[model samples]
Target: MNTTTSPTSTKNLVDTAAANGSFKTFGKAIERAGMSDTLRGAGPFTIFAPTDAAFDKMPAGQLENLFKPENKEELVSLLNYHVVSGRKLVADIGKWEVAKTVNGQSAPIKLADDKVRIDGALVTSADIGSTNGVLHGIDKVNIPTKQ
Candidate 1:
């Protein structure tokens, strides 16, 4: 079986995720949200990236709906909800009960049976470091609560 490993170098977040191959769906969503430039820009970000399988698990038609041009705002909001402004490793995440996302909302972190969960999604892979951030792979897609 192929295992996903974190990029150790200072590669940018977008490039790192693309190189990993596990984040193709997410990469597309990032582009659709017009967030490529932002994610590739300065300061560190902690992204809880959902794998392709995670996106697949979304209710049928939901992902398609979110991709619609008119739903851009919603898609962007959902994507932003998965990102925190600072680079946070697994250890740092363990120290917090809630992490504030770039979207201006808080994502609750839960520790149970030695597993870390964010917004009800399981953190399947942790601490994938990048040039501008770190990424954790989640098993399920996390949708931001409607404002």
Candidate 2:
């Protein structure tokens, strides 16, 4: 079956993920990182959005610290680790250890036993269609690639 999605249809995916309560933190972080506009834009994007559970795993003050004005760059870097340069699906991302991110850094892609993982985050849901790009829900937030 053909699974390509258009930007208009991404809303349904976002809405569905939200309603399921699995992506609340990811949704909020997207807004906080000021990435809603970019992700919602036209083009194919691969979003490795961290789940609410993932956010809960952070240290007591880490999440709050990341949202501070002083830490915007860090937050941006962290979020950028979740995105790639294009709409890369699991089949297209085999065995690559590094992929360029929107933040001008690289993210590690681990493909083992046909199980593809970006950083340590598994591709829980893939091929989420958006007008500009694609959204893939990830289980964890990937750490930024060091400069």
Candidate 3:
């Protein structure tokens, strides 16, 4: 994997997420999880990035609590829930109904006449390209595992 993980690191998770206005919350979570370097490393990734409005859905102060220094593990798991191995584009998804995430969990892929859903969130934006990965803008964050 390529190892140049800086603020402008190629097309990996970090840079791609940062470029997307919808993924601002996801990007903040990545930084809070201290996963900027790992996600920026060159390995093709498909990230189901949640919008900033999605973060707002959480209970007041809940998001801040999740980002606490002591909650890093949970934050990491949630952020990783968005990533899949390789550069999977919207067209590549086709009729596929499921994709496994980097966190060792599966997110269901739902296709509709006008849109796609990952787990429960609607994919509002699809196929944002990057050098190392692709990103889809999701309306909500998926739970990594069982609650």
Candidate 4:
């Protein structure tokens, strides 16, 4: 598990996800949640990004339904579960049993045998750098327990 990925990309978290290609669904979710500007803004944030394949695992039409304007609140809550307040490296995150997210909920963090898991999503890639923060690619979308 290579956690501390070294990079100097000038793009923000949103742009970094866009360039990753695999994060199309996560990127769109961010936009739909109206968080593109927040993620693009200055100051460090850590994002547990879910890959498009992860979104595919959702119940059929669930993703599309979440995109509807009426459900934006739900979408925002879900997306915010993946975002932390400040930039956190894998080791830093590992110290947190449950990390406080921007959405007011805490995501459970697990580090075992050198692998990292957040809210039941396995981190496939770690420590991707962006201008404002770092991102880790997850194998699943992390839904809050309440939802």
Candidate 5:
């Protein structure tokens, strides 16, 4: 008898986002923030990934300035603001008014009319599963304010 074990599926959050195509700008930001590896790790993270068009919604020169090499720390913090430490699907998030982020701050969540909002960005899609976590596509990039 011959038996073969199928390869274990292991596409993580970063891989999922990169494969989706709509998240190209967000993927680049993840690279600039040096967070590609972290998002690929285990332990279940929930990321609010903004699409390329969302990044374009920023004020003139803002996204460009944030992407500069000198602003890596700021870029990282901003990116982290969109990430929560656990897998929070739409149903799971329905109970939350605020979700703690990896950045050491909390992001306000608003749920109404079957819509979910994180900080001020509307969640355009939700519960994109990965080996390491889940992702929600947002229409705008969320910026964290100093608390």
Candidate 6:
């Protein structure tokens, strides 16, 4: 998987994630949740996006259910939980005790031994720069409330 994106790339966050090919399921989720335009828009945003393998770690049937039209709001909330308002690279994120997600909930940030965990999901790759913001690849999907 491509871990770092060129800081000079003109592509926006959505496009950068798409180009990496590690975020297929996440890309679909963003599109299905109707958050594509926002993530692609101007102004910077920080994303702790789960890799496709991370989506595979979800409970059976839950991933499928999240994509249903009736569950759009839930999907949106879940997706929003992976994002913050500013461009926080790993270094910037490490300085914060907690991050306020787009979902309006705070996610605990833990940094130790040169590794970072956001809301319990370990960051596999970080500081992938893009035109709109940065994207960090995470190992698991983080639920708003631990379940």
lDDT of 3 by residue, 1-147 (tens): 112323344556677777756677788888889888877877777788888987787779878988899988888888788889987777666477888888888889877885778888887777777777777777886877742
Write the residue-wise lDDT of candidate 5 on 63-126 in tens digits: 8888899999999999999899887787778679998999999989898887888888888877
Q: Residue 67 CA error for candidate 1 (Å)?
A: 0.9
Tens-digit lDDT track for model 6 on 20-45?
89999999999999999999999599
* Whole-model Cα lDDT of every candidate shown, in order: 0.87, 0.70, 0.76, 0.89, 0.84, 0.91
Q: Which pairs clash (backbone N, Cα, C closer than 3 Å) in model 2?
A: 7-130, 7-131, 42-132, 43-132, 43-133, 44-132, 44-133, 45-133, 45-134
Off by over 4 Å in 1: 1-8
TM-score of 4: 0.94
- lDDT (Cα, 0-100) at 71 in candidate 5: 92
User: What's the TM for model 2?
Assistant: 0.81
Which residue pairs does candidate 1 place in steric collision? none
For candidate 5, the 10 contiguous residues with the lowest summed lDDT are 1-10
- What is candidate 6's local distance difference test score? 0.91
lDDT of 4 by residue, 68-89 (tens): 9999999999998888988888
Off by over 4 Å in 5: 1-9
Root-mean-square deviation of every model: 2.4, 3.3, 5.6, 1.3, 6.7, 2.0
Which portions of model 3 miss their true places by more than 4 Å? 1-11
- Please give the lDDT score for candidate 2: 0.70
- lDDT over C-alpha atoms for residue 38 of model 3: 76
User: Which run of 10 residues does model 2 get worst, by summed lDDT?
Assistant: 1-10
For candidate 6, the per-residue lDDT at 145 reads 73
The better candidate by TM-score, 2 or 6, is: 6
RMSD of 5: 6.7
